[model samples]
Target: MRRDTRNRLLEAAEGEFTAHGYPRTTVTRIAASAGVSVQTLYLAWGSKRELLRGYLESALAGDAASPEDAITRFTGLSPRERLVELADLVGEIAERAATGWRLYRDASAVDPDIAADWDELQLLRHRLIARVFEDIPATALADGLTPKAAVDTAWTIASPDSHDLLVRRLGYAPGEFRDWMARTLTAAVLAPDSGADTTM
Candidate 1:
């Protein structure tokens, strides 16, 4: 089927991009890996850049419900509980999408189009983090910390860059990273009496 072929091409593109890096990855290699003709690969996605974009987008999306929808379920929980839930959600996303994000970050340095796309993705990520902060009452925020600051703190902590540093380079298990994120976010963003277990 057409959809199956497209999926295969995208998978092949991810593998090729991961194995060869975007600059060195070729359409021919991806096509060969996908068991498709070069023309078929071209038809599915016009160029290597487009193919990389498609693959990264697919990786970010995963097969679960949209992240926006997922965040809504954490509503009404206490601020600390919400942050802990958020850490879990972000950890899962980082596990799925961090590799693709790193690829995008690297490719963006050399490709104007990828740079633009990467900026857009970061903006979307910021907006999502802001939405999570919106649910936390202002009173619960650390003294002198504005809502914007709280969102920024969460955004930076939840970034793929952080995930890469802790998990890929430093060898943190995913759960350890998630727990660290929860504690760090709670300590940084919540007031002293905001019910955060900040002992660690």
Candidate 2:
């Protein structure tokens, strides 16, 4: 099917980008790796940049659920539980995509288009984090912290860059990094006595 072919190409592209990086990866190489013609690859995604964008977008779009279901789930969780959930979820995503992100960072420097896309993805990520904590009461947030500031703190802690530094560079186990994030968010953002302060 058309969808199957596209997915295959995207999957193959991920490996190519991961191994050779964006600048060094080639259409011919990707097509060969995917067992498809170069023309077929181009027809599916237009350009290598578009292919990379598609791959990154798909990979970054975590755990899909309907809006109603997501709201129900978040509302069911206590404030502290929410932070823990976010920490675990973001940690898993970062662990999976950190290497690919390194490639994106390297590619963005010479490619304005990729740089723009990366910026947009970061904004989208921030917006998603805000939505995750939408059900938590404002009083649960740290003293003097605006909702925007709280979200920023959470975003920074959950960021791929933070994961790369703490886990990839410092060799912290994935679970250790996740626990650190939950604890950090609890101390920095959550009110002192909020149930979300479960220690790591």
lDDT winner: 1
TM-score of each: 0.93, 0.89
Q: Where's the lowest-lDDT run of ten residues in candidate 2?
A: 64-73
Q: Could you tell me how far off, in angstroms, the CA of residue 32 lies in candidate 1 after the best superposition?
A: 1.2
lDDT scores of the candidates, listed in order = 0.86, 0.81
Per-residue CA lDDT of candidate 2, range 23-85, in tens?
889999999988999999989889899988877666665555432333344556778888888
- After superposition, the stretches of candidate 2 with alpha carbons farther than 4 Å from their true spots are 62-72, 196-200
Query: Per-residue CA lDDT of candidate 1, range 26-79, in tens?
Result: 899999999999999888888898888887777777775675776675777788
Clashes of each: 0, 1
Q: Which candidate should be chosen as best, given TM-score against the real structure?
A: 1
- In candidate 1, which residue ranges exceed 4 Å CA deviation? 196-200
